[model samples]
Target: MLKKLFGLTASFAALVGLPAGAWAQTAKDADPAIWVVKDADTTIYLFGTVHVLKPGLSWFDEGVKAAFDKSDEVVLEMIEPDAATMQGVIIKAGLSMTGPGLSEKLPKESLPALAVAAKDLGMPESALERFEPWLAAMMSAMAPLSKYC
Candidate 1:
C-alpha cells in the first residue's frame, strides 16, 4: 500500500513537471501511509494529507505512480469560487451583524488562545470579532498555513 501511494505521489509530481532530483530526498527514503478498501464493484484508496506542504518533500515513486495511472477517477474536496461571489457569500454567511461578537460568544478560557492566533495571523482581535464563530475558527485554522504555500 505504501509503495502504491508512493507511485501515485511520484506520478503527481512528475505530471506537474517537477524535476526528478528537485525533491529533498528520493521516494525510497519515505514511507507514507496508504489504505485500500475493496468491495464487490468498487475500490477506494485513502491517504493522509496536510493540504499544504513545503516544497522539497518527496515521497512519490513508480509503484504509486502506476496505481495512479491505472485509476479511472480522482476526487478532491475543494471548491473554487469567483472572488466577488465568494466575498458576497462570506459577508452574508460569515459575519455577525447585530448580535454578540465572537469574543463575547466564545468561552472565557478560549479567548486568550483566540487572541494569540489572531495576532499570529497578523489580524487584530477586533477584526476576528466581526466574524461568526465557524468562519473565525476556519480562518484561525487556515491562516497560519498561508506562509507554507
Candidate 2:
C-alpha cells in the first residue's frame, strides 16, 4: 500500500511539472497554465496557484469563486505546522543554540547596526545571539510575512 501510494504521489508530482525534492520551492514568475486530459469516462486536471499573495487583490472574480464552489473536493499542496509542532522542530534543529554569538561573529563595526536592527524588530540583541547567519537572515526576511501569516 505504501509503495503504491508513493508511486501515485510521484506520478502526480511529475504531472504538475515539479521534479522530486523541488516541492518546497516555487517558480514565482512562470506564466500560469492549466492542463487537462480527458477520456471516455475520466478527466484529470492540473493547475497552479500562487504560493503567496498580498491581501486586497481585485483579481479574484466571480468566475474564480464559482470554480472553487463547484469543485466537489479540494486538495491543498502544503501543510503548515502549528505553533507547538513548530517549536518542537525549532528545538530539534537547535535554532536557539547553534554556536558563537551573532554579535561576536559579526565584525566589530557591524555590531552596532545589528543591535539597532534587533531593537527595531523588538528583539533584544542577545535574543538572536545563538542563531547562525543563514537562520538569522531567514528570520529577518520573515518579518513582512509574520504580520499577515
Candidate 1 per-residue lDDT, tens place, 1-149, comes to 33432332233223223233354663343445567889999877765544344455665656556656767887755453554455556557877678899999999999999989778656668877767887677665655544443
State, as a TM-score between 0 and 1, how close model 2 is to the true structure: 0.44
TM-score top scorer: 1
Each prediction's Cα RMSD? 11.4, 14.2
Global local distance difference test of model 2:
0.50
User: Which segments of model 2 are wrong by more than 4 Å?
Assistant: 1-52, 58-78, 94-98, 107-113
Instruction: Provide the clash count, candidate 2.
Output: 0
Q: Mind giving the per-residue lDDT tens digits that candidate 2 earns over 25-81? A: 332333334455679976554555653333332333444445556566666675645
TM-score of each: 0.62, 0.44
Pick out the ten consecutive residues of candidate 2 with the lowest summed lDDT: 12-21
C-alpha lDDT of candidate 1 relative to the true structure? 0.59
Error of 1 at 48 (Å): 3.3
